[model samples]
Target: MYHVHLPKLEQMGLIEPSGNWYDIRRGPRFDEIEPLLRVIDDHRKKLPGDVL
Candidate 1:
């Protein structure tokens, strides 16, 4: 899963890996989608796993 998403994220300046860890600190691209991500996260938490 990491390999699948890494290239696109790197292209968008959203992650920088060092050693074995991925750095997910704030970046311009991430900022642009943070609000939407937060909304989705909140919604996800409210839903039951069976419904999901």
Candidate 2:
């Protein structure tokens, strides 16, 4: 399921791929404590500056 959305998200500007790395676009909405904070949010966060 998740593997299927990767390309779509990339094309939508939500994610950018570079070799084995990916960068996510950040914005005010990205920090919302609700949509992303909810356990039911459906996905986990992958910050650009996070240590892999």
Candidate 3:
């Protein structure tokens, strides 16, 4: 799955990868969506279990 998604994310400037490491540090796209992601995480944490 890394092979499939990492390149697409990199192409979209959402992430950067070097060797075996993925850089998910704050960036333009990440900054835009981080709040939404945090909201989703908070919601998931509120769930009972097995939300995925």
Candidate 4:
């Protein structure tokens, strides 16, 4: 995840990484996906059991 997922998410502006490996924060574009996240959270029980 450090080499692949994190970098990809950073590139997408979805997350901001601090200097420390375990420290991270929301990126500028987090708002762009917040609605989708809210929708998913609202319907999480209806999703496939393993989806989350």
> Evaluated with lDDT, which candidate comes out highest?
4
Which residues of candidate 4, in runs, are more than 4 Å off? none
Taking all chains together, the TM-score of candidate 2 against the true structure is 0.34
Residue 27 lDDT in candidate 2:
33
Cα displacement (angstroms), candidate 1, residue 52, comes to: 8.7
lDDT of 1 at 9: 74
- Which lDDT value does model 3 have at 7? 69
The number of clashing residue pairs in model 2 is 0
Kindly report which residue pairs in candidate 2 clash with one another: none
In candidate 2, how many Å is residue 8 off? 0.2
Q: Which model, 2 or 3, shows the larger lDDT?
A: 3
lDDT of 3 by residue, 1-52 (tens): 3378766766777766655545454434767667887888879978778975
Cα lDDT, all candidates = 0.67, 0.50, 0.67, 0.90
Question: RMSD, each candidate, Å?
Answer: 3.6, 9.7, 3.1, 1.5
State the local distance difference test value for candidate 4: 0.90
Error of 3 at 23 (Å): 6.0
Q: List the residue pairs that clash in candidate 1.
A: none
Residue-level lDDT of model 1, residues 1-52, one tens digit each, is: 3477776776787765555445455445777788887787779868778544
Candidate 2 C-alpha lDDT tens digits along 1-46: 2466766656555555556345545333334445545654444355
Collision count for each candidate, in order: 0, 0, 0, 0
Q: Candidate 4 lDDT, tens digit per residue, 1-52?
A: 4477888889999999998648999999999999999999999999988898
**Model 3, which residues run further than 4 Å from truth?**
21-28, 45-52
